[model samples]
Target: MSCHNPAAKIDIPKEAKKIVLAGNPNVGKSVFFNYLTGLYVDVSNFPGTTIDISSGKLNKDVVMDTPGVYGVSSFNDEEKVARDIILYADIILNVVDAVHLERDLFLTQQIIDMGKPVVVALNMMDDVQRNGLKIDIELLSKKLGVEIIPTTAIKNEGLDKIKDALYRAKPGNRIEEVKEIIDKIINKVDTESEALLLAEEDENIIDRHNIKDFNGQREYIYKLRRYRVDEIVDSTVFEVNQNASFKTKLSRMMLKPLTGIPILFVTLYIMYQAIGVFMAQTVVGITEEVIMGKYYYNFIMNILGSLLKDSSLIGQLLIGEFGLITMVPIYILGLLLPLVVGFYFFLSILEDSGYLPRIAALVDRALTSLGLNGRAIIPMILGFGCVTMATITTRLLGSKREKFIATMLLGLAIPCSAQLGVIMGLIAPLGLKALIIYCLTIFIVFVLTGTLLNKLMPGESSDLLIDIPPLRLPRLSNVLKKTYVKSIMFLKEATPLFIIGGLLITVLQYTGLLDSIASGLSPFTVGFLKLPPEVSQAFIMGIVRRDFGAAGLNDLASQGLLSGPQLITSLVAITLFVPCIAAIMVIFKERSWQESVLIYVGSFIISFLTAGILAQIIM
Candidate 1:
């Protein structure tokens, strides 16, 4: 929605003032937002973008948490959104990282130039002090002509001061060069902020004002403002020593190839143990076999049977093999839920501990071979959570070609946690050798596909230019809260898809289409993949949901139908197959229908061929 149209997404009262929380990336803006809004919050997608905007109440004011950006301009989707919100804000709570003042003050200067009432939440004061640096806050405040509230947001320090300072907020002094330009447009615009934006040639502001285009003098203004920021820092900031702290030393080790590679593997192994063994085997077994299968499923089936006999369509639809009540709940709640919780828990820990960016840095060199940089690691890691969401995150990558390559790789080989859990459980019985083979096969396919796409896809991959946040001990409350939120989101998004898949299966079974398709694919399934004809059903289910296919294989393995080599072959094929229908639809939405179709068909052919070759050798 347009920033001017707060009624579209925000539920602020007509008389309520707008308080915008603004900041550079990773500067504790979200933490501040949470503290101000508490539990009263609404998150919705911006009208035409995938970016989510969060709005909530702070006392009587409507507080908005905007996307993190460096300076307010239409450089990208995120910057554009943040700029719009800034333009419309009555008062701006500009959160700044004390440790990264040199980098962050650029945005602060931009906000000040907008002539908006602003209160600087100088966050991360603890980190700043720990790093042997100190800021003369009073002096800095006088220099910037704004209230600077020193805060350690995670610790809830200086939060009350922020609220108290809000009423004391005043417009910051404008940059001299920008002021001259603002004077030129003073009659054209009502506020200095609008004039500054107009001088920057912001298209949205230009359109709103119906003003003629002016040559943007953004670079000249930026350079002048940047010099002033340097002067303020030099006069008001102090450093005791340049010694690297322990966290910095550790961060350095994580960037080196030798140490970083081992660290990466150790991290992945830990994740696998947590999700694969603990959650998949132990937790899932308890939930699926004992609670659901032994007790809940039986109880539900008995109740359904009593209500409608087994021969009835309603009874079959409720408790039959592909029944909504039986399969949907069992698969979603029992099988996938534990895995989702476990995966998100570990992911939240890593994210909160600030190690994910280090991982991106560590893998940057290797990813170059895949026609991606470290930034692509974000989507790849996210793919493990949910390929559909990861598909949307591909926007973070640089070019269409990089996005295409990343999307293709994700579709071809990345298995989401739910599918990985089932695949782990199914293959765990075959011994470590079998699991190793399965992993190796998928890795080979991933590397080969990425390398081939790198060669064929015509474009240059962007270099990695990411800000590395300092490592901090993860807060248990924050980690748990994140896990809960992400888990709920996963359930909300995945439940309907699982239910729909179950319905599709039930319809196919009732019409004998499932059997017909299985029979038709027997030659390839049985002859080439060396899998039983029934395993063909899993391949079909893969299109509906990748984990559904893996779940189907789990059922076959449980029934003693799939042997060691056959199990490996089946898992390999399914893992390398196309992602779920949701991901394909997202691909179509993000890219083009032609690209989506090509990804689907290409993945299928590659998966089948790879599985066939591997099956012959293993057999």
Candidate 2:
């Protein structure tokens, strides 16, 4: 149940106590977690975009996020993790959905039964009021025997009160007896027994000699929770009309077969044109060429080049054609800059608007047939933006099997916006038929490969359990804030990889390793794919960034070396090759080393084979 493995406990930091934000799922726990931790929250959206926990620093103190659970005794994986955090957390923030106060109170009562010091955040108070619900906060606070603060997180309200409450928080005398009883029950059990009890909610416990105790303690706790939740709902919650609203209708419309697929196609079309064409081409062209190429590039190359000229190796590594100085600005500014920024903007709106879940539902059936759950679409959709980010998201997939399949498909089939853009730009000069072939080939590979892997891989499939938030226009301020945070995170993570990649390439070229490698790969290059031997180094550059190889192809296209058929083959190969190094690093982070290596090799072979086949057919 605990996502973190149990190792010998580290000593708590001398300066600060670790406070954990705990709550039921979809109760705005993450939003409160974000607010409490401010800019320090580590935003990890797993592959399915399902249950993720984040940690943030609150002053000198640390705030941990536990996945939402229904109750401490619940069978769900998240529930077990919640109970552990409750037991271990120095302080707890029990977040409750104000609109569904009764349902939220079930988990609250579980935490209360454990006797941890907790403050109740009555989140979504604005929504509660809009539905004609009124809660006597003071009375409810007294009943729960904890401080209750009303918060409308989307509006950024009530955060100050939470901070103030944290400062003043102390263990309540009211729950002392209950806490002592639970602690006694817990401490008496062995680690294995404890885990079993937590996961199975087993009421019976046997000692070392097999003496069983059925003292009615666990049942009594269960009865108490039922009574408390019923009492709270009758007293606090007031749902008006109680029927599906307009937003609910919209949600249904977005998932229905008749309408959903059309909407999805339209959305993808807009996304492609918006990010791939306008951002990557129009905006990036101006930034990279007109401004950077005209001024910054000349200044850096002239100054740095002159200084290091005495040592050719140092000069080339620093400022030559393959140098970090030469490649960083071009790769970052030309290829990544526009697409990354644009994607952040796009992602902000989708996440905030809460339409992603509906889209998942719509595409669920199709994806499932390929041996992937419908929720896997989230990362696949994200792959169009950047494979690195998408690969990191694979953490959301419930099973390792699913993660492996998704990662492999992503590396082999999904082209990031930069590569897609360049392909579209290059192939369009030929005709739309070239574009169709390009797309159809990739889709066929994605499906056939995923299906085969699904059959070959051994593991249980993850049945998708996803939250479908009410459809609403995203708040502009929230969108901007999320976009800004993600953009900063991307730049920080990627810049170093870009610089190092460039420097490595420069070194390889200077040492003659590049030529040797190219010569070795020439058979596959010239004979099968019918590409020039120099294109081997291009493939090497692509390991650093997919778009870097794409830019390499653009250079070949400029020199008129590749014919129409060869151009398409090269494009397909580069696109399907292992996603850039950033993506590979994320694969390592999300999956095991064995799984990541499998994906890397599988993608490498698949890309080359597909390219070779395409060359034969087209030529």
Candidate 3:
């Protein structure tokens, strides 16, 4: 079958052409995207999928960026998104890491076989030469039947040639045997891209095209293509030195058990000091207490009180205890904002420096006992940022079983940064023993719950298969940009929820519902958990937002309503309580309504039971 264009499948202006940037993970695709599009970029989920795609303008042409993938097929959501974009784009910018030319060429060849117009960006050229490797750019271009541009994306080298190379892009030569097999199925398939996918036995494409299954043919075609890719790399690339560098030695140490474990703890300690001690305490005190509490809250409440009077319902709604003016901004802007910034900033540094995957590798074995691989660490790490966003990210896990276990763990055990910060501040004053007990209890719960679920849940777990990128010094500009974007996204998503939560709390208070619920929960609070009845109010606030609950507890502790043991018990209970409303909604969206509800109910039981037992022992 001749190459068929799938560009017509998606709607775009007739005059507008698309240039898609595609490559394997950590191949500098983002750097290229930022270079081409600069600061003007929009990140959104692709239609009908949770995978995010970034788009921006390059001169008059629309430039699009796809999630990183090894090859173009529906092996995962990211690959599916990448394949769809490649299918629809007018041209492709295939970024290849020159140092890993042999490994990256497989995807490069797959794109070529799709008959899509492609310009090869042989990226990481500086890394190549620094490691004493070389590539014959012209020879590689000639072999693939596409233009090759050697680029060091970080240094902004050879980037200007990209625009001109777009016009010089060409389809890669196809394998004759594979072509023959595709020709036989040509009448059934509509596009060359679809044909290639079909030949690879892609179920999604086959189902979409209503084509017959070609199961055995895929292995044959894949092997043939792999052979061709090997031939291309062998002929066009040369490596001068085989000696391991310090980075290589460090990478080895990071993957080994003894060294890696200590490294992991040290890393966590550093993060805790940076985020928990410095940012959460020092930065948050200024932002939440001095700025928001002493200034903004007072300023706004005074103005609103004068305008509507303290007894007025409008005044209560605006500036009262549960008022939007008093609580919402303080919780979101003053409290959560600093924590989110600090968390994302630290995360971005780890991500850009290529340390995250190594950490994942180190933990893979331990996670396996919980029916997860190191891949679970991504969402777990992100859960520390925001469990709601992490729930959505659980889709990256391989199976429904993995996703369910991960989601449950996140909902039940992982406290978001905002809540963590407040919890730390509250527990820190109780002395080191209290703090250690608090952390140890949560960690024990996390492992035990995961182990229990692993046994109960059906299906075997998948192993971790991840790319380990070379460590590089993080770019300040890139790290700051990601931090800014993620922070803005957090604010936009969180602000409205906080306002709604504040309004809901005010209405509840005004209608006497808050008091009634607190009274109703007194038996559970006072009798079961061995805490003051007033602590029930914090539990109610937790349903609105996790941080709100923790902050409420902080307020009660400040007033001396909770003792050291009571503080520890309450912190543990709230930490494992029903996930905040936002997280529950996301769980409902990502999992089913049934699953979300079960998780909600299950967490409440587990949290209360655990806390009840702890309160009895500790007190």
Candidate 4:
């Protein structure tokens, strides 16, 4: 647990020690991390939900919440990060679901072998009890050479004990004894398990950087584990009850191909309607009209404008009809706020019910042909919320090829909630056929591009490894807390960009750059695509931020400048065009400047070419 990296700061307070909440996905690690840190990290029931690390200060100490990984191997990028952190942590608050102890224990064994400071957070104990499942925590603790604290993170139960345990615990040293115990446990494992175990512990088998040798060292660890399994199992503990219940049968049915596909469609339909339609439409409508439209906008414009009336520049910049102030209230209330809350609520419910992995499994074959695995579905689904986050989540994909394709698809095809919200609002009056074409156009592009990318990218598709947890009723407290956190995240991430984009447009309009660019691009807009020159201005706005661009288009469309074909063409072009500034920035951060530029230029070329073609066809 100690490190000689002098630059690395480990501020261990005299009173409290840092506790890291680590576990596989959907095990309430974030809820536990949030409970300890007193900061809301979105805790969804879905696996691969948290791609990037979210750390917060916990009572004078820091608590880091790592993305859930099934193993501590370098097979995937997220797992590698998790492995590195576990290797360096002072203590691992390993959270496992009580109901799915066996499956959860798979990762616990990997952690125990890594020989780091360890504590078992047996989370979701209530679920265990409800299902008539019993775990001998003491026995399990002894078997794994770690402390076990049964918890219900959703209810905030056992958190004090978790805190107390960390406070009292000393920094961990590599457990030679536990490592030997893992050796014995490996003997009982099958060839597959042994291969994985050895590969993880092997010093020479590099999963990230190019390795001199591709030969796996998994067999060596398998031998070591086989030699020690009996002692570990004997010292540690487990109890098995095989009496099948209704939940068990239901869980099986969910994974089966026959019944699962229909269920998945129904679930997706409900999710789209609930999050995309109801939340984006009804809730956003209420907030935008009742709050921002009626109160905030009038007050800001009138009061601020009157105060700065004599200073024409200041008045126009701060409180003009099209200033950031005028846009801020609407942006937050109409697009960002409602979408975050509604999407998170729906996401939390799906996550809690353990349907996410099943969805992945159902879609895995399709994803594989698209150059991704079932796991890629997580980021692809999240792309609807924010491509920036989804871009970061390319780390979860097993291969570089898969990651590249996923990132590209997300950047090119996925429309964030803000974009969707604004688009829905603008096209609402245009009828369902228009909306359907808009939807179908983007989806077809996603699939076609994904299929082509798969053929072009050189690599075997990754095998889908998914864990399906028992379906449980989502706890209301957890749902609300998660939704609240995501809302805050959305606002925090989007607001500054929205304001800056607004300011940039205002400046462009004032400085005549907008007119020059619009004029330059007018041929493409009016002549090529048969749209007004102003639509090209909207495309410029879209590059800065998608919703801002959509709002600008909304202005033109409302003025009757666009016909049906032109509106549809503009929508398609804007959606397929370069990602918003935020997504582009994320791509730059996660990948590189070159990749980001490729995304931007490639998207622009493809979008415009397609738009021109589509305009001709429609015309």
Instruction: Report model 3's TM-score to 2 decimal places.
Output: 0.71
Q: What is the C-alpha lDDT profile of model 1 across 224-275, one tens digit per residue?
A: 8778887888988886645647776677678889888898899999998889
Clashing pairs counted in every model: 1, 4, 1, 12
Report per-prediction Cα RMSD to one decimal. 9.8, 12.2, 9.6, 12.3
Candidate 3, 495-613: lDDT as tens digits: 98888888888888888899999999999899989999999999999999988889889989999899999999999999999999899999999998888888999999999999999
Alpha-carbon local distance difference test for all models: 0.86, 0.74, 0.86, 0.71
What TM-score would you give candidate 4 relative to the actual structure? 0.66
Measured by TM-score, the strongest candidate is 3
Work out the TM-score per prediction. Answer: 0.69, 0.66, 0.71, 0.66
The global Cα lDDT (0 to 1) of model 3 is 0.86
Which residue runs does candidate 2 get wrong by more than 4 Å?
A: 1-69, 73-246, 302-311
For lDDT, candidate 1 versus 4, the one ahead is: 1
**Greater-lDDT candidate between 1 and 2:** 1
- Deviation from native of the Cα of residue 247 in model 2, angstroms: 3.4
Task: Report the number of backbone clashes for model 3.
Answer: 1
Instruction: Write one digit per residue (lDDT tens) for candidate 2, span 7-47.
Output: 11323366677688877777787777777787876644322
User: Which scores better on lDDT, 2 or 3?
Assistant: 3
The better-scoring model by TM-score among 1 and 2 is 1
